[model samples]
Target: MQMLDGDVVLILGGGSGLGLGVARHFISEGASVAIFEVSQTKLDALKAELGPDVLLFKGDVTSVDDLTACRQAIVDRWGRLTSLVGSQGIFDGQVPLRDVPVERVSSLFDELFHVNVLGYLLACRVFLDLLEASDGSVVLTSSVAAYAADGGGLMYTASKGAVLSAVRQLAIEFAPRVRVNGVAPGAIADSQLQGPKALGLDGVKQSDIPKEAMQEGFKRLALMPTLPTPLDYAPVYAFLASRHNKVVTGQTVLLEQGSLNRHMLSSAGVSGGIGTPLG
Candidate 1:
């Protein structure tokens, strides 16, 4: 049987991008999946694509009522939830802190935090009981930005860092019952992630970067030399969400494809690994 067999998962932001990809993979692994998405368009499209197998709900993750209603729906249908995969987030357009107008700082921070950070928190909160009851898990999406610099601009980095921290704390709180962990992916290929509305960049997508150009950039700097698709990441999330993940909790797995494995000066081929075979 597949690892996720007999599991029931609720994916926040599962209408498109990474969430959507994970939902599909989970289903193929024999798990029943439901997705909470804010986009009616994505949800409608999913109804046609995912058919009757996956439950689709339209709601913002930042709102308690929205999440509570979705939690009820999951309970009504699946009877229990095995895991919650948080894949909802927005980028900050990589705008430097100094460049951002002082007047918009508060708005920008609130908007980013509300979705990227609070959304994850609210989902975990609303589903806490189900997860505990089922001995389930929580797998969240963080980013390499949380550990190192330049993964995103100031606001985005801070938000993802917050996610990393939450995974640690929530894991402790939910210990011996539900596992809480996270994945910090880098340069997701074909990602549809957009920018923050407060920065007037909500329409801007990371895919706007030319695919070949982006791939080339990753190849040059990353040890893996290949940008990872959501599919590439599905197994990690699957394993962590599954009951098989007994030893891990309160940990955010750094999934940067060995890009950060080298010293800071190594990306330019300045030579940092092994150090000439250590003399």
Candidate 2:
């Protein structure tokens, strides 16, 4: 039997990139999926690609009304909600504090926090009742930036850190009724991750970054040489959202490809199987 059979899932920002990938994975696992996205164009594209098995709605993550309406639509169609996935986020182009213009600082901070931090909070809040009724789970999309520097700029990093904190707190508060967890992926290649309009980066996407440049950066920092795709990280969210996973909660799984520990050990020098210890 499929892992998520009979499950009803709601994914915010599920039109493209990791969100889109998660939606597809859930559907394949026998879950009925509903997506809340701000882009009509992306929603239309996803509808055409995934067919009617996937429900699509257009809404901004920052709007409580949009979230409420989306939830109602899901309940009206699916009868109940079994899981909630928060996958909406924006990047900061790794613009350091020194480079950030003072004039743009406040707006940039607000824009990124609204989508990255506030968006997750609002999603959880709006879905609380449905999730409680079903004893469902929440899987939030965090980033390597949540725990490390250089993963993103100041604003982006701070916002993701807040996500980690929320996962822990919410887990404690909602215990025995709902599970809250997170997945922190790192340096995805060809991601549709966008940036803040306040910084004139709304049109900019991670896919626009040169592949060679991203590879070089990853090679220098990551112990694992392979750069992951959004599809590669989808199953983690699927596992977390599954009803079978009852023990794990209040945790943020690090999907950083060993980048977190690269500082202490070098994968570059190691080759072949484990050899005799050197004296």
Per-candidate TM-scores read: 0.94, 0.93
Query: Model 1, residue 166: displacement in angstroms?
Result: 0.6
User: lDDT tens string, model 1, 169-271?
Assistant: 9988988899999999898888888898888998999889899998887776688878888889889999999988989999888888887776566545666
User: Which digits, one per residue and each the tens of the lDDT, describe model 2 over residues 52-144?
Assistant: 878899999999999999988997898899999999999998888888889999999999999998999998999999999999999998898
Clashes of each: 0, 0
* Per-model lDDT: 0.90, 0.90
Candidate 2's C-alpha runs over 4 A off are: 263-279
Best by TM-score: 1
Error of 2 at 99 (Å): 1.7
* Model 1 misplaced regions, further than 4 Å: 263-279
The Cα error of candidate 1 at residue 32, in Å, is 0.3
lDDT computed for candidate 1? 0.90
